[model samples]
Target: MIPARTTARTTRTRRGAVVAALLALGLGLSACASDTDTGETETGDESAAASEDETEVSIGIPSGWDEGIAVSHLWTAILEDEGYTVDSQTADVGVIYTGLAGGDFDVTFDVWLPYTHASYLEEYGEEVTDLGHWYDDAKLTIAVNEDSPAQSLEDLAGMADEYGNKLVGIEAGAGLTQITQDEVIPTYGLEGMDYSISSTPAMLAELKGATDAGENVAVTLWRPHWAYDEFPIRDLEDPEGALGDAEEIHVWGTSDFEERYPTLTKLIGAFELDDEQLFSLENMMFNSDEYADEQAAVDAWLEENPTFVDDLKEAAGV
Candidate 1:
């Protein structure tokens, strides 16, 4: 068996590489201040101010994931209402996990367990904290237009030319994309199909464009996503199980997150959203053309749900 120290050393090395890549991608150290090098002392008048400011939580939102964006904004709005400041930054998945492990980010709401993001968790699980899952039955999927001729992932290989021989995808660094490249392609013999890896927004834009014009389009997507409610899409049957099984969605944070904000942690831990609620919330945020802003969209949903925030706080005993 490998020694624990060696495994830790290997993780650290991989994490360092992730940090370096993030920096090169222009994801600089601007999201959150490092705990050890903040250059501030906890004493005197400054101490009181620091103590008050310590209630602030830094959250990292992985780009292109609508669920994370929605929940992160929701937390920020509600936390601010509760007199706690919230900072939300958009970053790639690699950068987000790295920041959480290094204490550069206080929390993030979009960790997919046992499958998507498994590699990142393996690397940084020791330094970061798992705050428990908020949503279960989360899934990774390869979706196509509902009217498409191909009904399953297996059918794509034979009729590759019918769908323009392309599979639109999200961020190249995303775990879903990694799985698609490593497992889906090989398992389904889809190496002949051209896979386009771009941002989530780009993939959505392509989907919308194709669907609008009655063109067949295939893209990587996930459940609890607004696209299902907003677009005419259906999940292709995965007989090979190349896409993996359904997993839970977790909220992860810095190691001392619980100790630093016990009440908030409790509230977050008790937080849970069923499929109807989650899908409706995302639909408001993504489907509505009027509420262009994330916060505005969340506010719209809260207005519709009416008692959701207050009810959640009461349930958490906070």
Candidate 2:
């Protein structure tokens, strides 16, 4: 009887041990399944978030230049087509450079280089990388109404006595304005004349009024600008070269930003517009009746010029 009882206890102990081992194995398998499911769900969510984050960038431009705004919007729309959302802001050129240096702005397409923005470039050129020239042979020029007797910039120098001893200029801080103050006026020996540095819109308004009334009006002008098309004006010859030689409009961004956003960078680097294309775009923005909004004008241009868009994309390797 004692031997049988001992054998029975041993058997019961063995059964309990086996049951515990099997229960532990089942729990281990369930934990692994739970971990695998959690990992897969997390990865899927992360991927979706990353994809959503890639569709946008921000740009900066100068204030009140409707033409610049339209061009910027065109580029933004092009980027949108390539899976990017774009935001733009308008400020002074100085502010734009500051913002870009701080990484607040991703790009600027309106930098007139080697002259207009020489100081800015000297200060920040090393910090930023030049993409390429967008428009060429751009410069500050003096223009007069087609009917005016003042045939050239030199003609205006003697007529200052009749014209209130004033040379009408654009915004006070503009590169053209500075050139007029530092070089143009001095070179022309018009030191005693009063200079009127007005805002861009104001200057345009003055020109329109003067031209419509058939009076002599001279103001700063540049190529590829809408003012040239809207008004029948001629660029006054620059004998003294105070306005400097012809320059190119450049595209620029913060250093290494292209590497950070390779696709956007390449697209920006590939951007280039000839005189005709830019002039057309500017004219549409400033003179078109089809659209009142600058951005709408840009959209229309893009719709009409799809081939150019493809070329830009191809150049960008997009």
Candidate 3:
């Protein structure tokens, strides 16, 4: 009882200590708020980058067609430049169409319509969408060496043995081969000639060898092909139209393709490649020793046609 009393000086000191502690606690709370705000800003930045990364595209390309390869790579380059991740798959044309219908692929570049790929469109047209035609004047042709006497497929029957009794053709699954088997051969009386079914490069090799050796050669070819310019070959006149009418090379995609990529759909729809442009681009990619490095080939092409990228971007409204 005797020592329980506190002095005024002691009371003042305790009040001062309590005020100092409150000030320290307030400073700590302010520092915590600042840290939380900085952390939120950093998290938002990371989220934005991840969102950009999530935008992607998957393209299916027909294995034997150089045109498909060319445009697929070109699109991949363009999309990558715009910060999209792109995947390119090489498969047979039939497989590509099926994949598109099943949603396994996002898009494809080389769909020949009205004649070529007619059957594919019939089978999958309901599930897929035709983005647009990029090139017209596409057709199947039977070509001969420039000096050959055969001016048309009608003349090939009698002169079959003169050209080694054989007609060199591309892939067996190709629409061209189908047309030749079902229509062209019977219409032109070409059954007497032995038909050879092989890959495009193999057929091209045969054509080049025969032409280089000064021998007569007959080949199944198509327009917008580089062989016409690279080798001296002339397409036979198709008076009967058995090889089918002129086609439009189109871009095809899944049903939801436009909804998923409105900008890209516009860009692809606006794309145009005439005979000269397609031939040169294909020649650079397919006929060069440097083609194993496809990106390099595409880059070389873009360098040669410098305005193409700007034109595509402008068309896409990017």
Candidate 4:
């Protein structure tokens, strides 16, 4: 079982704890330059020369998700190449939607739709434009050690009795953790199963400890995440399918954005990454120490996949 944090520490320790937790799970951030001054004057000039370049566009993303930052940096780099300035901030999902609805932020590329963030879309559906999916077949999942007898969520049904009636989860309020508490436990008749929905690092620490001891443990897991690459784990089968089928990551832009920056909007709309591409990018940015530099990673990917970059540019009608 994972140790619980006091109420005070819970609030104050989230951000730092999350980063540390990710590192323990083998997801290390690259040693890239701070997002503050990229010093890409030449590319910034080109972005300005592009048709419909905005003076500046602010993008909001959920706090603690490094992948989002990496994606934003890549987009910013590309936009700079085309002459548009990008300003990115880390805010909660609520602020992101509110900012997008009120035109505080021009766009957000981290909307996990049809499941998580459904309520936000319901509220601001009309104020934002849907800009297609970037990543496909991504979903919240439950993963277990490969050697564990629990092959699926079904195997986890009787786990509470065997493993101290405790199920480890990520931070509270996270969509995946909430769903597991509200649905998975009840549907699976795990009424006695007590959930420990702590920060990602706490959960991972417990997971590591359990796996090392060959003890039964189940935790919230997701794709495009570094855990799969770092650990020997298998996704538990979702017999009830509470997790839903493969969902796409959608992009959203403020209503005025399209009219004000058609070229930039088009580029955002055209941005798409297949699983392999995204995995490669994520690995470079989060998994490997040498390749953590965001710009360097983007530059290498652009060199290797010139055709894909050209296609995105052409789709933007550049």
Q: Pick the candidate with the highest lDDT.
A: 1
TM-score, structure 1 vs. true? 0.82
- Residues 234-282 of candidate 2 have per-residue lDDT tens digits of 8878877888999888887777676656656656677888877887888
Scored by lDDT, model 2 comes in at 0.67
lDDT of 3 by residue, 1-318 (tens): 111111111001112332243344331111122236555433333222323323677788786777877878777665655546677677778777887898877899999888879999899999998999888888789999999988888888888988999999988878989999999999989998999998888999999999999999999998878787789889888889898888898999899887776656767877887777787888888778975566667667766776775665456443
In model 4, the Cα lDDT at residue 281 comes to 75
Error at 154, model 3, angstroms: 0.8
Tell me the alpha-carbon RMSD of every candidate.
12.1, 22.4, 21.7, 10.5
Position 65, candidate 1: lDDT: 88
- Residues 1-318, candidate 1: write the lDDT tens digits: 111110010000112333343344432212224346765443333222323335677888878888988888777766655456566677888888887888877999999999999999899989988999999899999999999999899999888888899999999889999999999999999999999998898999999999999999999999879888778999999998998899999999899887787666767888999988888878788788888577777767766775676577557654
Deviation from native of the Cα of residue 164 in model 2, angstroms:
3.8
User: Between candidates 3 and 4, which one is better according to TM-score?
Assistant: 3
Instruction: Estimate candidate 4's alpha-carbon lDDT, on a 0 to 1 scale.
Output: 0.66
- The Cα error of candidate 4 at residue 57, in Å, is 1.6
- Listed in order, each prediction's TM-score against the native is 0.82, 0.80, 0.81, 0.76
What's the true lDDT of residue 156 in model 2? Answer: 79
Top candidate (TM-score): 1
Instruction: List candidate 1 stretches off by more than 4 Å.
Output: 1-53
Ranking by lDDT: 1, 3, 2, 4
Pick by lDDT: 2 or 4, better one: 2
